[model samples]
Target: MIVAPYMLKAFLCSVGLTWMRSRSPGAGISRSWARALPCKPSPAGVAAVVGTAAVPPCCFLQQGQLSLRGGLRVPPCAFSTLGWWMVGIPPDTAGTSSVGLRAERSPVFACSPMDLSELLKEGTKESHDRAENTQFVKDFLKGRIKKELFKLATVALYFTYSALEEEMDHNKDNPLFAPLYFPVELHRREALAKDLKYFYGEDWKEKIQCSEATQQYVDRIHHVGQHEPELLVAHAYTRYMGDLSGGQVLKKVAQRALKLPSTEEGIQFYVFDNISNAQQFKQLYRARMNALDLDKNTKERIVEEANKAFRFNMQVFDELDKVGRSLGEEAQDGGVPVHDGKGDIRKCPYYADKLGTAGPSCPFHAAVGLARQPLVQLVLAACMAVAAGAAAWYIL
Candidate 1:
């Protein structure tokens, strides 16, 4: 008879448990499972068979080793109960035994104890930190940036999220996305459009231009949507969750700094009218993700995609920083506020690379250029002498 590997493993487990019961007083075996029964002693050391349940026949047995039809290997009929702890196998299949079975073939649906949420957190930690530490975000929150810079950021975000949400909508029918897809509750297109109108006036459609970085990000999303739709989950998670959390904080900061009223026109992008409670909605989203039927490999791929999403966001920040640097001359010429009578531009490492020197708009560079001109130097010396004489006259 053809014996399934699982059945053979069950038979071996029952034999081992019955032997233990005979030797030990009131053995740990559940009475309802294996009732005591009499039988002739076998060379396998099984003194009795305790249950009437039918066990399939083994394909081959040699040298005290039992070989089953399926790909299973047991040397000396050895088994441990630990592997069954978190598995979904039936408890009564092996005469109420909990022993772990050995199989040459891997389990049908292998999973990690860590669910989707933990996987995302661990996988994207580095990328998340990099995104947060970007100079563009720091300056934006501090209110030391121009409104035009903020508008540029919003435009880039519009393009990125537009691509992502479009892919998600198209792939909503996919089995993997169906569970985690909450388009109505988490969608940002309408809100972003309202904010765009506020930023660029009614002609935002004609004025808005996507940065190169944003184009690259959108292209990646499109590629993934066509070739690997499952990856869109990671991008959705990265953008939506961030918009709910840090994005809200930025909204309040920008409103206060830019003196924008708390209206849809100014801050609609951060407003989630559909989702009243961000934390509760986030928990529900995570629960859906946790309940997804994904294998270990698929989960790993999603995690990698999430890290890529963060990298894309950081690239947008870099592009925004470049845009901000282009406005340095304007900022120095009273287009934006000056920090203590000088350019209010931040001289962080990111901007330092763009400007080629430190300290806002590089006042030192202007001084050096003026010093190179002999006429400018002679005029400066004459002014200093006149100022010195005026100071002496006033003192006298």
Candidate 2:
């Protein structure tokens, strides 16, 4: 009769434990003995077999190695195998057997050094910081967003996603980009269209036009999709990952600040209905991106393209800020304030370094208002001049 490998290993382990208990007084099986069972071959291509009275040539005992007959010896195993099980404990000479084995767990799937997901994240961190600090983003986070600007922003997103999704669809069949093509779960064009309709009425198509900044972004996406399809992964990773990470926070801010209905109108762009677990979906997407068969140069190019995507987003934000300034609408006060109980302005998502420190109430806006004042500007300029003069004098 043939026995399975695991079954054979189990039987050997049971026999070995019984023999050890009978030969050595007070020798008990350690909890780790189960994991250390010789189920697979060691690194030297030798199977660690347990036998009675005599052991194979591969099994020998030195100082602290496992032994079956006279002395305990264990052959070297792969790092992966060592990660799975603990090393065998040496027998005690004082008539007592105590097992000391340390268990270490290793990653199930070993990742390559040049993982695409990790590369993109580290490369775009600076760009991400700059994007978050944009005046338009800060205002939106503070619930100071105007309705007209918000509608315009939605229009921009609609056009941008329209172009991106079209390109993604075109390249879905390509091997290099096929694995990352998640149409149903990651696509946002349809959702953004619904948001546009809610904001611009049924004739939303006629009323909304793509801003120049958004047009530039759309043009780049189309170019990438048509000419350099491999680079499409960068744009996809930037937009989709950002949306999944911060979409809910932005949605709540918009809904509260705009006084939109609780039924989730005007913010469908942020609502990912198809994605039940956004975090898990993001992890899956990252894994797919990392699994793509791209060389080092292509990975670097992708990272560069992701930074360009961030720049495009920043330009769109700047354009929106300009339009918002022209509208002369009062900032809405419906945004949820992020604080650390001490009313720390730094913790506020709206806080930017250029906007100066916080004030007693609504510090971000207060700093912005103060900076905009002619007197405050002149005072700041004078202080800067005085500091420069002091430094020059000291140098001289």
Candidate 2 accuracy as lDDT: 0.63
Model 2, span 1-396: residue lDDT tens: 133344445545545554554333222223133234433332354333321111122221121222322242323221222112222222222221222212122111223347788788678878877877898987776678899889999999999999999999998778678767777667898888888888888999999888899999999999999999999999988887777666566776678788788888899887876665554355445645665668899999999998999899999999999999999866476545333222222222222222222222467755775665545555565565555555556655
In order, the Cα lDDT scores of the candidates are 0.57, 0.63
Error of 1 at 236 (Å): 0.5
Return the clash pairs for model 2, or none: 60-73, 61-72, 66-72, 66-73, 67-72
Q: Score every model by TM-score.
A: 0.55, 0.60
Q: What lDDT would candidate 1 get against the real structure?
A: 0.57
**Candidate 2, number of clashes:** 5
Off by over 4 Å in 2: 1-113, 334-396
